[model samples]
Target: MHDAASALNPQALAEAAGAAMYARDTASQSLGMKLIEIRPGYARMTMPVRADMLNGHLTCHGGFIFALADSAFAFACNSHNLNTVGAGCTIDYLAPGRQDDLLTAEAVEQALAGKTGIYDVTVKNQDGRLIATFRGKSHRVSGEVAPVQR
Candidate 1:
């Protein structure tokens, strides 16, 4: 398994990871998250702020924004073809998200050491307004994301 993994190129690994993860990700699909781009240690995703996702203040709920960021982080950390899971995460809201807004989240890996990694996701609106920033720590477990050629 390790030899098969090591034999795959970086881009091949990322593509396989994305395909495998998307096939099993129901929550992201159910929430209407659109995957824009993915590569090794990076991912971009978009979500529309729907009316059903609004809070009492008539703005998009913080939870929905956090979810979008989290999904982006998950994809970024897992792009290495490892079965990685989030160990911890944090988000800070900068601006209120409104209904009908197209929010895009871009996540990038900050550090990877041993079995742990750190990622940062920036959530922004279509108008380029920052909505939130998220940080996620990931832990890679013992599994391959997909079969690879040795």
Candidate 2:
């Protein structure tokens, strides 16, 4: 079993893990976030700025932006099929996301060691304007996101 799992294609494993996680992620689905791409230690997601997501200033709420980035971070960290959770995270909003804008969050793994990993995410609009930058620290737990296929 170990040999078979180890022999599995890395890209295939990442895709499978992402699909399995997305299927059970109600928050992402309900918020209109779409998993755009996935690979080993990388993930990209997109969410549209809807009217309901605006804050008092009529800009997209920071929580919503954070959630998008966090989802991307979650997907990237768990790409190896291990169940990983965020240990800590920080985000800086660079610009306001206007309604009707299509926002995209791209997360890249900066480092991975033992049971912990670091990821950086950049949130951008359809026109490629920067919206936010997020960094997340992840801690792996005991569990496979998807059962290994022989």
Candidate 3:
């Protein structure tokens, strides 16, 4: 399964991967998440904390923040076009996200071995306040993101 799709250069692979995933990512799109940056084993995305995203406490719900982090993790782990899925993940909230705030999540690969990998995601608000920290474990499945020269 170590094919050209997996062997593509970092930038090219990131482009291809994002193109493939973004086309089918209705969840991220519907949430108004935007891809800011992407590279091999790395991705950054932003989501706006809309009024509807606020909870009873008048802060953005943790689930929305988690989704932003998870989305970044998904992109980072799948940057190689290896078709990865989350095996497990955990997130810690550090600060509250307020309405009208733009939240950005950046994910970076921490390690990779065999079919499993680890990624760390940091969520922040527009004011440079840390909102959450997330760790994701990924399992690669058999597939190609797009056609690639051998």
lDDT of 2 at 102: 97
Per-residue lDDT tens digits of candidate 1, residues 15-112? 77887888889999888898889999999999999999999999999999999999999999999988999999999999999999999999999999
What order do you get sorting by TM-score, best first? 2, 1, 3
What's the TM-score of each model vs. the native? 0.94, 0.95, 0.93
Q: Candidate 1: worst 10 consecutive residues by lDDT? A: 1-10
Tens-digit lDDT track of model 3 for 45-145: 99999999999999999999999999999999999888999999999999999999999999999999999999999999998999999999999999977
What is the clash count for each candidate, in the order shown?
0, 0, 0
lDDT of 1 at 72: 95
- Candidate 1, position 51, lDDT: 96
Work out candidate 2's RMSD over C-alphas: 2.3
Candidate 1: list runs displaced more than 4 Å: 1-7
| Residue 133, model 1, lDDT | 97
lDDT of each: 0.92, 0.95, 0.92
The local lDDT score (0 to 100) that residue 132 gets in candidate 2 is 100
lDDT per residue, candidate 2, 1-150, as tens digits? 234755388887798899999999999999999999999999999999999999999999999999999999999999999899999999999999999999999999999999999999999999999999999999999998988757
Kindly report which residue stretches of model 3 are placed more than 4 angstroms away from their true locations once superposed. Answer: 1-7
